[model samples]
Target: MKKACKIYDEKTIGKFVDNELSSEKSKTISEHIETCPICDSITAKYNHLSNIFVQSTSKQLDKIDTDLLGQNVLEQIKREENNFFKKVFDYFSPKLYLKIASIVAIMIISLTYFQERLIRPLDIIGPSAIVNSVDGNVSSVMIFETKKSKHTIIWFSEA
Candidate 1:
C-alpha cells in the first residue's frame, strides 16, 4: 500500500508510467515525482504493477498455439468460399434454365393470342379514298385498297 498523494493522484502516476499523458504533463509529473516522496512511491507502485501485467500477458501468449489458430481460420475461410461458389453454380443448373425457357414461351404465346384476338388490324379502319356517286352505264363497280402500298382501286365494268 502506497501513501495517498496530494500533488498528483494514482491515476496521473499510472498515466505517466503508461506514457499516456501529453509531453508537457508527463514532464511536469516527472519533475513532481522526483521531488515528492509520496508521488515517487505511487509511481513506483504503478510501474511494478505494469511490469507484472506485461510478464503475465507474455506468458499467456507463449502458451497459445498460434499455428493451429491460423490453420483453423484458413480452413473456415476456404469452406465458406466453396459454399458461396456452390450456391452460384446451383442457381444456373439445367432445371433452372428449363423453367426460364418455359416461362418465356408462355409469355410469347400469351402476347400472340392477345394481339390476334383483342386488337384490330390497321387496315380495318375506313378507307382514305372517297367516291361520292357513280354515274350511268356502270354495270358493276368495285372499290378496294392494296395491302402493302395502301393504294386505292376503283374497278368499273360495263355490260
Candidate 2:
C-alpha cells in the first residue's frame, strides 16, 4: 500500500495541490508524506476534490447561450445605425466646423504673414561674400571669367 501524506488544512492543502507551497514547506510536506501514511491519504483526497471542482466548472460553461448573445449584439447595431446621421451631425455641427476652420485659417494666415515679412526680406538681401573660380583650358577660362563677384575671384587655366 502507498504511504499516506499528513493532513493539511483545506487552504494550505489547496495551495499545496496547486503547486503553490513555498519550496521549504513543500520539502517538509514531501518528507512527512514519505513517513506518514495518513497524511499521504489526506493529500490524495484533496487532489481528487480539486480535480472534480475544475471539471464541473468547465462543464457548466459549455451550456451558455452563445447564439442568443450574437442576436442581442446584432439588434444593438441595427438600432445604432437608424440614428447614425443624427449622431454624426450632432458631433460635427456648424459651430464646431467653424471653430476648426477658423483655427486652420488663422494658422495659414500667420504662416503667410511671417514668411512675407521675415523670410522674403532675407531672400532679397541675400547671403554674404561670393567667390567665383574658373579652371579649364584657355577658351573655357575666357568664357567663364565673364562672371563677376564683388568679393575675391580666382582663375586657373591649363592651356
lDDT of 1 at 137: 88
Clashing pairs in 1: none
TM-score, cand. 1 vs. native: 0.45
lDDT of 2 at 31: 85
lDDT of 1 by residue, 1-79 (tens): 8468777778878888889999999999989888999888877877788789999999999998887888999998788
> What total of clashing residue pairs does each candidate reach?
0, 8
Residue 103, model 1: lDDT of 95
Q: For every candidate structure, what is the RMSD over all alpha carbons to the true structure, in angstroms?
A: 14.1, 18.1
Q: 1-159 in candidate 2: lDDT tens per residue?
A: 855233565567567667898999988777877776676667788878888998998898888768789899999878876787967866776797979978999988887879867666565453334445544455433322222322233454656
Residue pairs that clash (backbone atoms under 3 angstroms), model 2 = 4-37, 4-39, 4-40, 4-41, 5-39, 5-40, 5-41, 6-39
